[model samples]
Target chain A: MAAVEIHQFAECITCHAWSPDQSMIAFCPNNTEVHIYKLLADKWEKVHVLYKHDQIISGIDWSVNSNKIVTVSHDRNSYVWSQEASEWVPTLVILRLNRAALCVQWSPKENKFAVGSGAKTVCICYYEQENNWWVSKLIRKKHNSSVTSVAWHPNNVLLATTSTDGKCRVFCTFIKGVDKRDLGEGSSNDLKFGEQIAQLDLSVTWAFGVRWSPSGNTLAYTGHNSMVYFIDDVESSPSAQTLALRDLPLRDILFLSERVVIGVGFDCNPMVFTADETGLWSFVRYLDERKVAPTSSKGSQFSEALGKLYGQSKQSTSNDTVEPSKFRGGAHANCITCIVLLRRSAATTVKRFSTSGLDGKIVIWELDNSIDIQQPGYR
Target chain B: MAEEGFLEVENLEAIITRIEQKSRKIESLLKQSKPVEALKTALEGSPLKTRDERCKSANWIVVHRAMMAIKDVDAMFSSLDPEYYDILMKYLYRGLATGDRPTCDQCLRIHEKLTERAGLGCILRSLADTVNTV
Candidate 1:
């Protein structure tokens, strides 16, 4: 079977997220409407129309239970929508600090969520005891530029965030001091704010996206000059060794599993890499070049112009991080901006993936062993 | 009701006449090399109500012209400028190689005529090779 499937066409799909249970696929098109397609029913449906944002929706993520979804927008507000009374309703409104909210994520085990805004701060909003729902408690503000992406560890204890400042930081949540009160009016402080566990300085220009591995041990992030850095022991080391892919400027990174790292380049191709036991990474699968129709005359003309501008020098520069072998083909009609992997069931052996690009189309690909399964556990 | 009906007809006629007069003025301006002012005036006259409407209209016009112009070979040749002829030829060759599509045949014939007239042999062999691999 083909590794990539053209799922649907003609909608400006900006971001997509698979439900935790992998029963439904949620995508935001042009940031105008949030579309939810149920996999079981094989039907297309609009779960919510978020007309609140004057700008496009930048990021979206499903809650741990898959009953709710958190969305952030260029409008600088992060919204939480819940499925209640057989209808989707807006539950929480996280007011950001006067900047566009670029990314958002929900904690793995708790009701809390994190929002990364265009400002230099990453806000951690958890359920307030008085309001009975999630609210913001602006945590670390050390980032110099806007925080572009944020990811929560699978254990729900560590939170990783990336920013335009080219730095990624992991923050652990713990009770600094808690306040206790008996039936009396007097109260005593018992819990205090927790300190940051570690800070990984990437020192790159712009860190676009970050993702924590399934095991919560490794964190992958995209930086300038088409480089992707995989920090295996993020908690132990304050610096991550960068693994750069030559000639492919990656815009996003998604960890399909523990060893398999999928980096979506600005050229709109998904390059798969597998890390061996010695920390050496191997170029595994190039999913983009397969099953693409021949380029049209107009496409050729565009390619010729582009080739002239960039030149036909395929040689890898020594300063380049990843070797030229890591570069993949089968480019999209436009830049591939976002990608999400959808696992059907824990028992199921195969996992399917989806990618959305600037061309306003979503392409879904099914990964199976029949088509060159390079990774060990994949087969 | 009769008075209102008369007023509506008069308003429609007046608007049509005003549009015709403006179009003539634009034609004269274009001929006189005042294309920027003429384009500005034409755009202002047909100002789109919303951003979506404007985008839809622009896409419709481009697609419509491309589809309609491709229907006749003579018309396509007449419309092609010297600078765009090579680009059009490459498109034609690409289209023909894409066999099983009738549009490809149409484009091939156009390229054949242009190449014959300009005495430029098929320069798209390398491009064809690259596309066939993908």
Candidate 2:
């Protein structure tokens, strides 16, 4: 069973981040105030409130290894918070942008982080010990529109940034003092700071989500055209292959393995896709499709609700067609905005993953070993 | 593997049911000769629940065509999803008035930069009107 908890009522949760131990959660309730809550006795206790940003907070990412919370906001500023005694202290980051910041992400190595902004810039921010504050370098030449999301490469030197221009661009964010070595032999960039070498524009619609594969060999992004594309970073000019999807467009995605990925969005469910024997990635099955039967309708005078109340209906029994139910047989009530891969010992399989969304629910779903996704159709 | 575009039996049934329900509303409005209100409900009833930009944009694109089918951009805007008012404005600013992309599919074509952020045109005009009255 998937354990789901409703955090707020009718308010969209813009973004969320969990601590390393998964005991505490930091989320912005589509407001300027950032709420930090801890898990106590199977219930969430509001531990502290970090009220600083003047505008609504856009995104939050908790650094697992560093125990720091970094947030970017519509006010065009970013802050890193660390617990001191009983309160959280906020250190201002010099983003130096003209427009609102959309999202923030920390690198795996925890030495640096990246912020995607509406100013068509991805600010690769790092702590400047000399000044005792974090500062950002601008990557603005290639992107022609607002950058929506940013993901850090596994090596912590590369950054994948997506924008409204239907393109996903990768930049080498190697700061002199932060990165000790040069770019890998397989990387396409020139190992220079803020140089974009791999520019794979899907040529369909904007890419709102981008994730670097765990191995850092491939980059996957969800396009606005209901298409998922993966770019191999090894080629002189990285080539992108679109992952086939017959359903609605995906908003967010995560790499479960080098070959398998989980995409969640308007579908109100998480879908698992895996690369075939020939290395072609294909949709495997919906991990949340627990219902095999149609819902029972209210017999007499019928008026069923619609909107974010139900999933996209597939098919049903009886020739007349039955109405879709509110999150009937699915785990989420509405569009899933984000998915976080939980603690896992294996690279190819995920023991657990959590999803939070517009429905105001954060759900943790555990995977069953019986449904092996490597097989073409696990269902 | 399942066939392309293949939905499960239950899903298909529920989808058909939802379609039938909307069709009934469209039919009743036509019978009452209030196609504008009929179209208004359709546009207002859009799936903002998707929250995904592509899905939300796609839903509005379909509603845009429905408005074009009725040829009443005013009524469509009157009951437009406030969340998508900017999307519709951007669609118009880019002169996608014909409801056809360069690729000719439902794929995205117009640039979001084309929008005139709360300028004299679009809803800002109505907002100005209300402000004057108050």
Predicted structure with the largest DockQ when compared to the true one: 2
* Pairs of colliding residues, candidate 1: A176-A191, A176-A192, A177-A190, A177-A191, A177-A192, A178-A190, A178-A191, A226-A249, A244-A322
The stretch of ten residues in a row with the least summed lDDT in candidate 2 chain A is A299-308
TM-score of 2: 0.66
- Candidate 1 lDDT by residue in tens digits, B1-134: 67755764555545445545656666676567554344334333331222233332442233222422344555444644444443344445545664646666555666556654432222322132221211
Candidate 1: misplaced stretches above 4 Å?
A: A1-4, A20-23, A39-48, A175-194, A290-331, A369-371, A375-379, B1-134
lDDT of 2 by residue, A1-379 (tens): 3344445422667788888888888888789988888979977888988889999899899999889999999999999999888888999997999999999999988879899999988888888888888888888789999998899877778788888887888788888888877455654334788887678856345677899888977788887656788887533557668764545567899887787788988767788877766667777777764333332242111113322123234333443235323335566777888888777545643357778888877777766543656444313
Instruction: Supply the global lDDT for candidate 1.
Output: 0.61
Give candidate 2 misplaced runs (Cα > 4 Å).
A1-10, A182-190, A234-237, A290-329, A344-350, A369-379, B1-134
